[model samples]
Target: MTSTLVENHFRIGKLPHIWCPGCGHGIIMRSIAVAIDELGYDKNDVCVVSGIGCSSRAPGYMDFNTLHTLHGRALAYATGVKMANPDLKVIVITGDGDCAAIGGNHLIHASRRNIDITTVVFNNNIYGMTGGQYSPTTPTGEKGTTAPFGNIDRNFDLCNLAKGAGATYVARSTAYHANMVKQQVKAALENKGFSFVEAVSICPTYYGRKNKKGDAVSMMEYLKNSTVNVKAADKLPKEKLEGKFLVGEFYKSEEPEYTEEYKKIIDSFQKER
Candidate 1:
């Protein structure tokens, strides 16, 4: 199955990715590929966009029409791409820092406009490419190179942020939950309006070592133990839910997609002539 996905979706020459060993970005990237393959999208009809970051490196390895755009500007570029050619399937690959920090304004506005783009966030909780700096999604009290003592700022609940910003679909999964990530990405791709999926990943080299979260296996184990599926979470008592984050689909709704609305205006204007 893995070999089939690689042959169908990945660039063979880019086989060996540069992410540090045990970094979960690879798993998240594979999940995206698997989702695309399962959906059977024509490679040419799919457009993947990314911004500068470790996670952003994924587009170079993917076989789809991809754009490695400027830092925090992937959405802006993707919006133009979708507007110019609404037939394409647009997907954005971004890191926690790239999406929630410098690119945060774009994230919210894209959701506000309900554009037909699927955004998958590879959130390792630190700025892995630039150095082990704390990111917007870095948990409060977690240590990073910049926050050696501990991070004092409150972290953003990205799914909630997207849902509040008007994303038509919102979901969360982890690298440890590879199948779940694939399923969520598939669902996000099918949503017509803006879609957001947060794939919680591990930075074993930096975040793990700095916060003493142990090796890659231990981090994966932590994810397995710490997250509760939203469906089961409702049945569990408050005490059982403490310290456990919720995963699974959080929200979904039907809405007018931004590009389609723009086309409607153009059509109306042409009819008036």
Candidate 2:
């Protein structure tokens, strides 16, 4: 693939990223950059926000107004930024643990309010940063440092969570599908209200070794083969979808953006006065 499109967008001095060799986070980050490029968004008009985790490190390389916030607090910071300056194109880069666990309440409310910010959750299913702990999206029976015996806890379907919570756009893609990731992210960016894209990523160093899922290549291939498009999944029998997940845009709707609604309220108050 050509680097021309994303080359200028990144800080070349930060060339060697801290992510593990073969980690999918890098691919996801590149996909986001590609989406931004395709959408013709001016770098100055974009703000990238992230929470603590491996996935959150993306903002360090991207040459944009970036915020590295507290763990699971990316949404809160992004919310504040967008509310204060609705003209900025706010995009959030978060991890499964950061978005679905401690930051989950923020995720729900952000979607509930239909805030004008696009979120991309790197769903690696395990916390690769602070140690290889199983996160909320960890598949049942998956092994991690904290779940050496295999996790029995139910996993959260992030896309469904966002859609159900009222996000105007919701989609899912995997790192293996780089082009699809870019497309989904671009679509999310174009949504007026809250938009979410879940990028299923691979953590080869920790999650892979702990679970014996083979190398990063194998894990990526698993994501490619194990997931069906949402349309195809609908036609499949329940038994066929037992071990497979669905990808592609699952939901979308028109809604009043939170910032826009807030502005209307302020305007009404001024008129009343």
Candidate 3:
């Protein structure tokens, strides 16, 4: 618990997280912890809420006040938590399946309402936890247990979805770029309105080998090559953009967050009383 990411913010007995040997969840978790530390959040002031999935296990491993909630309902719980205690920093960590599949409606409405919660989605393309299955965000042409012939369905463009839903901050990063992930998370925390971050992850056991992508290490390599920051990538040609994802902060704006705005209404009511 003494690494740069674990600096003075971790609680005891949460060490030795239980991710797979080649799993990317651990890397993203480290990024989150580091971001929280950089943002000067105390363990008591931050709450990590998660839905049922491998990513949901993240909160159990963190030292903060955490909530392991129902499947695909992390956003709903996070919205309630933020509304109840506007001063607390609420972070939602959910798997792609849990967030984009079962919990998709909540995700959209949460963004539309501009809740003050920060959402981090661990997207491994395929569902790694409840067996290797297909999630809504699974990339087209990727093979999963359910999609033996390869997935023909379209995948979500998470940044665009968030921006369209009215989130004030939206960004994307992968496990390969751990440093930038932490940086973006910190920025998301500082933003007043709803924030969404998509953390591209690798499931070596389920997603990597099945798709002939080799082990987890190789999957991370794929992420390293498949993504480009818009600022640096715009100079490249259309061919350069082919099959590559645009990362970095895609959008950010100043807007009224829902919870605090509701608090202002209550304050006005108190004055009238």
Query: What is the TM-score of each predicted model, taking all chains together?
Result: 0.98, 0.97, 0.96
Question: What local distance difference test score does each model get?
Answer: 0.95, 0.93, 0.89
Q: Considering only N, C-alpha and C atoms within 3 Å, which residue pairs clash in candidate 1? A: none
The window of 10 residues in a row where model 1 has the poorest summed lDDT is 1-10
Residue pairs of candidate 2 with colliding backbone atoms: none
Local distance difference test, candidate 3? 0.89
* Candidate 2: stretches off by over 4 Å: none
lDDT of 1 by residue, 28-141 (tens): 999999899899889999999999999999999999999999998899899999999999999999999989999999999999999999999999999998889999999999
Which should have the higher lDDT, number 1 or number 2? 1
Off by over 4 Å in 1: none
lDDT-superior candidate, 2 or 3: 2
Model 2, 4-123: lDDT tens digits are: 766778987787799999899999999999999989999999999999999999999999999999999999999999989999999999999999999999999999999999999998
* lDDT for 64 (candidate 1): 93
TM-score of 2: 0.97
Model 3: what TM-score?
0.96
